[model samples]
Target: MSRQVQINKIVGRLVAKKREAVSLTQEDVAGRLNLNTESYGRIERGVTPLTVSRLVKLATLFQCGIDELVLETSTGLTGQAQYIANMLDGVSSSDRDEIVKIVEKICALSHKKHLKSIKPY
Candidate 1:
């Protein structure tokens, strides 16, 4: 497949997964987007090219980042970090500071647990 086609397929799969994760049916998503069920199905199956506006709408509907829908190679913590960054993009500085503090605390706790689990030489 061509590069764009491959990317579409990857994005389609990710979108479908996200939709399912939120317990939304294809018909439900179609209704929300004002699209026909078959047309939305094609987009989910990567048979149709998903338009940029539609993609943005899907991201908004799914409460996720556009990069989560578009970037095929990002996965695991990398993808999650990107998604979190996207969510933080428009937040106030105080909100961002609070979120950073929470994340730092979580990381520090995780690091402590990891260190305890390791048998020191």
Candidate 2:
């Protein structure tokens, strides 16, 4: 696939995942975006190219940042990291710190659990 097509597919998957995360159906999102179900489905499937204005609207509707919708860096974070960054867009520094600490703790606990599940060599 072309680079743009790949990016579009990635963005579409991200949007679809976020929508599902918030318990929204494709029909529901279509209505919210003033699009027909077929057109919206195309967007979700990356058959249609997304415009900046539409992207901004999606970001607002999804409660995420535009960067999360568009930025894809090979050397930097993408996917869930981008989503988390978007979520932190308007958060205060202290709140961000607290969230980071909580995430770290969760990761540590998950790592411990994973280690426990491993059989000895």
Candidate 3:
């Protein structure tokens, strides 16, 4: 397949994931976006190209950015995140959540420290 086809597939999968995350059916999303159910299904299956306005509407409906919908999230993970995932392998979901919370706290503190060090540049 061409690069555009691959990208379309990624975007479709992301849109599907976002829709499912919000507990919306394809038909529900179609209604909200003023599309028919069949058209929406085609979009989710990567066979339909979304217009710019439709993409914007989808982003709004999903409470996410257009980039988030178009980008393949698994391919965008940071090296640190990959390492964390490796360490989290086989861990329980609750434990993984706790570990992520700790990491987030540390990252927030590091961000604050970095901000304080940027002296009016």
Per-model TM-score on C-alpha atoms: 0.64, 0.64, 0.63
Per-residue lDDT over 20-47 for candidate 3, one digit per residue giving the tens place of the 0 to 100 score = 9889999999999888999999898889
1 or 3, which is superior by lDDT? 1
Please list the C-alpha lDDT of all candidates, in the order they appear: 0.88, 0.83, 0.84
In candidate 1, list every pair of residues with a backbone clash. Answer: none
Mark the 10 consecutive residues where model 1 has the least summed lDDT: 66-75
lDDT, candidate 1, 27-87, per-residue tens: 9999999999999998988888888999999989998778778776456988778778777
Stretches of candidate 2 above 4 Å error? 72-121
Ranking by lDDT: 1, 3, 2
Instruction: Rate residue 40 of model 1 by lDDT.
Output: 94
Worst 10 residues of 3 by lDDT: 71-80
lDDT of 1: 0.88
Tens-digit per-residue lDDT, 11-92, candidate 2: 8877887788878899998998899999999988888988888898888888766765666534545567766776688999
RMSD of each: 3.9, 5.3, 11.3
